[model samples]
Target chain A: MENEPIIEVRQVNKSFGKNHVLRDFSMDVNQGENLVILGKSGSGKSVLIKCIIRLIDADSGSIKVLGNEINGLDQEPLDDLRSKIGFLFQSNALYDSMTVRQNLEFPLRIHWTKEERLKNGYSAVMEALTDVGLAHTIDMMPSELSGGMRKRIALARALILRPKVILYDEPTTGLDPVTGREISELMVSVQKKYNATSVIISHDMNCIRITSNRVIMLIEGRNYADDTFENLKKSNDPKIKEFFT
Target chain B: MNPLSTYIKESPFLKEIGEIALFTKRFFKEIAKPKQEYAEFLNQCFWIGYKSLILVGVTGFIMGLVLTIQSRPTLVEFGAESMLPSMVSVSLIREIAPVITALICAGKIGSGIGAELGSMRVTEQIDAMEVSGTNPFKYLVVTRVMAATLMLPVLSSLANAISLYGGYLGANIRGNVSWNLYWFQVFNVLNYGDVLPSLIKTFFFGFAIGIIGCYKGYYSQKGTEGVGRSATTAVIVASLLVFIIDLIAVQITDLLGLT
Candidate 1:
């Protein structure tokens, strides 16, 4: 169980109309590894993770997450599988209408019953908020928060379920450098806290340097290179070198 | 291909109709399945019903008053002044109030649903709900559509009663028509025939408005511009649907000899 890949993609292909976004892309993420998927904008980084969750079905090939082939799993099983995966969107998709508490509780409302919530909901919310250093923002709406704070709250909500596999889509794309670093550090702490595996999609060098154990360079819709962050930084292959330079 | 067949093949309109039909079928299937959102449904009812009541009532009153006043001059000219209350009651119950209320809801409730859901879709909140392992369609679409479907009739009924009172006040505007006489005329001329057909049509009107609004918002593309477009199209399409459904209802009532 420990040696088996936590998330596996075997020759996955996806396209939008004539735009072939992913051309026979394949990857394997081992247990507790922080795998940063580095790619330019519109390079199918987001599509790959969405496919792993079956949010968008792959055009062809296999994706197994936590040992379940997810391509055509029934709704009941798909839902059960989803409870173990936490996704942090690039936009920090906190419900704008809901307060921070409600935003955090939205997942619980769906996945847990009344009794389970009554017992542990408050503490869980408090713990998550505390982890993100936003305990004071429980009653605040997302619009009231700054971009960094919203991202933190989204991270808190994603971690509230204590998911085993966390996917981050361009986690620090829009933040100032200091705030982005803070998010990167928080992400690392969370990985330690849960011993969770992460597949982060980001082009931020500082974030990748801080968080990635292994880096996968996605170039032209394929995993062009997979190596340690240090090795990738030293890569001479022009496609991989262009990213570092 | 002939023009008609060519139009059918190439027209986005036909394609949209097919898409809407599929979306409507999905709503039915999603509603019948497990995982209904009762709390959210109640919340949507508060928004669609309680929020829209006062506006509907005021419009009804104004419509009734104006109809009575305008008809009074024509009746007085014909020396048929006593027929005011009976005519106003029949006209309001049979057609005007329902159509007016539905058109008003098309502007208010339909646009509201479109903008709300459109913003949600553009923001990825709907996708977030899906990622959270919840059916966004079941929560967002079904609850709002169901609320709109149920709320329109209740609002229309309230509007009808208010409009009758407004007619009474309007009847007294130019010349004195006693309260008792007005009631006598209203109830005496009114049969199940006048009320039933209009009430039945209001349900159809409500369904059309809600479904159109939801459909526009659910499939909204682009971003903020798309949201604005969806809201506008919701109002336009729903208003058109209200008229179409009303015409069909009237034809049905006429065929049944209910008119």
Candidate 2:
């Protein structure tokens, strides 16, 4: 049981009115592995992650994170659970009104006591910013940063809490190839540094290849395929082959 | 029956009312929670109160001057020209100043809060705040609502004083009335009854403006377009609610013999 999955989602079904986003979808993310959920546009990848965090409630399912059932936890426990899970939204979701330092401090302020934050908040913010190589831009607003910079800052904010599980929603969607590759490399390094389990939702094959230890193909609202990237790459099935190609 | 058409026609409006009622309930529940956002509340007071002073003052002054100027000719026909200061002060202290000042704030502060929060919602900043384990509703909505509720009465009182000053200036424009005499007349006719009802109503006005603006913004959808809609709708709804609250306040005050 020591090797039990950190995240276990079973038979999760989500629907918006008549549109079924996730149907009988189930997956398990083991400890300390980068698991990428690959899906095309409108394939409910974003919704899936949102459900994992309870940002969007599933129609019906069992979602357990760190062995706690997430579906029915009250607000206090839900927030406590969320503090241990870092989420990187597709849009970065950086507070445009706040400086990068303030953005990174937000999570700390919420989860840590004032005394604890006073002791370590400054160095923690600096450490996260330095990890992403943006320590100099701490005072700058999110609007002042470029797209890639914003993404990095967002990632830094996500990493600041040293979350046990990091969920990335489209981490490299809008960046150029070089910048995307840099982010991909950063993801790998961050994973190694923290030894954190990450569930990344992206369709970028390069990013998947660079970061994912294991990949799950999300097609037609189900876990269509699950295997190592190399093994999935060599598959003969057309649905699995389309992703590799 | 065309189910889709019927759903589109009725759902949004009915759903919106239900959502707003639920939002109001949530606001009360959250406001009672411990660990109030004192820093954010002060920041909002500075923005909603301090920042709105100039506009409210100018509008109040202009309203007083124009009302005095317009009423002068009518009063002269009745040989009641000497009653200008008293009449103007009473009208202003009782209704005009508070209503006008509230409308100005509804336009400036209400729209501002709406657009700012709407953009935050669309950008997923609200969601980020939630996921970060911070109470976005408490930090954002409660602080803003409390600031508006507390600040509008202060702004209204300031506007009333400025309007009385404007009335004196207008009175001196045509005929010479000394400042002492004008102040004497203005204060003589004003009482606790007149002032209290007007000030009491403004708190409701402020509450309506803040709640409506926050509700619009918090429930915004459809991205940038939704932001624009929230701002516009916030102003409209708040302004309308201001008038309705005024009507109810007037009736209540009348029943209590305060007016």
Candidate 3:
């Protein structure tokens, strides 16, 4: 809950061949801070997250996570570095071949404890599911769950690893307002409980309102505005105003 | 130029070459790195190995039966009807069953892994994996390749046995070869060389299919349509690689006087 930033991006750039998706984008995520990123479709919001995780290599600029430079690190250390961050995909990205329990157990099995020490892990999964209000559907397949439930399961999976930072990509995009609000509330509550840093990518105003104490608007791969929700609402920039309108 | 050779020459060789190059590149990248996602790998193996048994089994049996039946008349004409079981077993062990099984796997398991991974790629699950500190390639490619390499040989072995059974059925339908005599002749002609080399080659075929399919799918570009295209292309490319690898294996083994 201190003002120490856990994630820092300095002028990162990425492009697919000729098409530039992210250009000179920089942002900071403080420890225990819930920072919601608002951007229109294809504005490179997801790319920013991708750059942070090193999924897609950045074309230029340096990214530091917990004061460690991530861009040039070898695969082993990068993977070790990756174990500390949790990602909740927009589609939930649950392995359709696995049941919910299997899905939650997957990351833990790989990155955490072995099978013998799996009780704390199981309880953590159940705890995450309960936090997201999905404690009853432990054995269900991803295909069998509703969209909201799937997202919850994905959140549980992400949290099961007990990561320091959780990056949620379009968490509430596909859900109904009620479900979406519930998700936003869950994110906020989870952030408070874990005292973990959160970076959410969404255009949903409700998500921004509920989850973000700090909002950063990305317009055309650069920060359009960086402020609290109220200030973003009152900003005189036409594009920013138009976005709210 | 003759029609068949000309057609082969005129086929999309460059596209195939590009695909092969891409596949090789992706495989090296996957192996040259770390970030092993064991959970995802085991899951893939379960899908690619455990679920594919029935299809490979059925095809293996049919291939044996059909080849035996078709070859019986030719053998009978040469007064070599007694060689039917041996001939069928050799054919199944050396070529038909392994290749056919691989083709089937390319169609079933290969394309499935391809499409699933391709779709995951397009939808940003792969990206999510990376940002979350997971290596998509290790999690996606190595597990799948390892699964295919391990499972395909087992499937091929099973296919060979079933195919011999099919040959027995086909031989008994009209021929005079008894069960004991048929198997005895087959065993008499069979050597460790014929069986082992062919079996050894099948592991490569499995590896090729797994790698190529995974490569095509993992690097799949575009969106939903791209995923579908990647799946189809993965099967086609992996099947073609199986043939190429088989040809190379034959030449190498021949040069070494093993086959």
Candidate 4:
């Protein structure tokens, strides 16, 4: 990975009325690295990821993604910026009324031209599904799939655009251990294949261990700790040790 | 006393009204943008218009039949049984048909849109669309509102036609009024003023139903309970707005000397 940062969050703060969530948080995500954010439930991990994608505006701060200031862009330019960033929602957010193929085709329909889609849409969809090992389920509705399969389909949809940055919010939260590990493994392989930078929000230790090049602990709405999984595990601070134990 | 209850009752109403006004403004702004969502708009037209025909048709037929039958005795007492078709046709076309059709749509299409979009919101599908660089509001809201505005007028027209036919059948039930004479009487009493104002009002009714439905759904929170609340609230608000719009339309028509 290069020394240049792909994402820079500076002194970000957010609050929902009286309940402050993010308290002047700051972090940097370098290019071509898998950075996992670990936090307890309701620790603002999801909010942090949302801020990075401009899905949720920070109360105060500056966030730069791919060298563009997120807060300053207009709707059209923001949309264009978003096309280069993929997000895997915790719920998968697959359109239940549509088939997996249609769900996968949705992003391309928005961002790609008719000629471009006609030339490469099917092949692109096939490649994404193949990467997630769910090519057979293309015509199936999301309701027909198991949780793990749905996660895989969501991952495939995220990858279809060949995005430079993928934001994964709890990619393996609801799956069993084996399936979770499988998803984690796929995350690593997909990272290598696409050379895509990833910021994963997760509390699953196994997921963090398997997928993260570095881990950041979000505690009290700040970057409480930053280190590798092994080093973080060896830390003696009570809050850091709480996660490892 | 309960200060919280007072705040809950008073604040949410004012707050919701303000929010709905803002939502409506945003919808207008988004709709004015280029590259309308045509495919989704057509799909919504099919769902909201074509699928709603049977219910509106049946209700209108019954309304016309009942009105004719109920008025028959009074007309008989006045020795004006011949006036039955004119009276029923005027009532149906001038007011009953549009109101009934809009109410039915409020119950059916409004609730359906609210629940569908509410569930999508809760499940994060809307957010997912936004994150994927798609304009979910344009794709979801504008098309639905436009479809409802255009389709309700057409549905009302169809319902008015069916109701006249129903009035004909009711006229034949107790007397030997020929179809030709019945329709002739009906047409003689009708004019452009009677039809035009009623038709114009229905477009507003349709717009209200669609906008309220979308507003409820698009901003829903608190998960599944919120979805149910959105559907129920959409129907109630749209149904109420239909009457309010009808009342205003009546006053306008009266002032314009169309009534």
- Candidate 2 per-residue C-alpha lDDT over A1-245 given as tens digits, one digit per residue, 9 for 90 to 100: 43579999999999988889899999999989999999889999999999999999998989999989999999999999998899999999999889999999999987899999999999999999999999999999998999999999999999999999999999999999999999999999998898899999999999999999999999999999999999999999998898777
The fraction of correct interface contacts reproduced by each prediction comes to: 0.67, 0.82, 0.51, 0.90
Candidate 4: stretches off by over 4 Å = B1-10
Candidate 2 at residue B149, lDDT?
A: 97
What TM-score does each of the candidates earn? Answer: 0.98, 0.97, 0.88, 0.97
Which RMSD does model 3 reach against the true structure? 4.5
| Candidate 1 C-alpha lDDT tens digits along A7-57 | 999999999999999999999999999999999999999999999888899
Candidate with the larger lDDT of 3 and 4: 4
Per-residue lDDT of model 3, residues A131-242, tens digit only? 7888899999888899988888898888876788898999998899999999999999888888889999999999899999899999888887899988999988998997
**Interface DockQ per candidate:** 0.80, 0.87, 0.43, 0.89
Model 3, B1-259: lDDT tens digits are 8988886777787656676677668767777766566665787778888898888888888998899999999999999888889889988999898899989998988898889889888866676566555556777788888888888898999998888888898899887678888789778988998889889988898898888788778878998999999999888888988899889988988998987
Q: Please, what are the lDDT tens digits per residue for candidate 1 over residues B41-147?
A: 99999999999999999999998999999999999999998999999999998889999999999999999999988988888888889888989899899998899
Model 1 regions more than 4 Å off: B1-6
Clashing pairs in 1: none
Determine which window of 10 residues in candidate 4 chain A has minimal summed lDDT.
Answer: A1-10
Name the candidate, 1 or 3, with the larger DockQ value: 1
Count clashes in each candidate, considering only residues at least 3 apart in sequence or on different chains. Answer: 0, 0, 2, 0
What is the DockQ ranking, best to worst? 4, 2, 1, 3
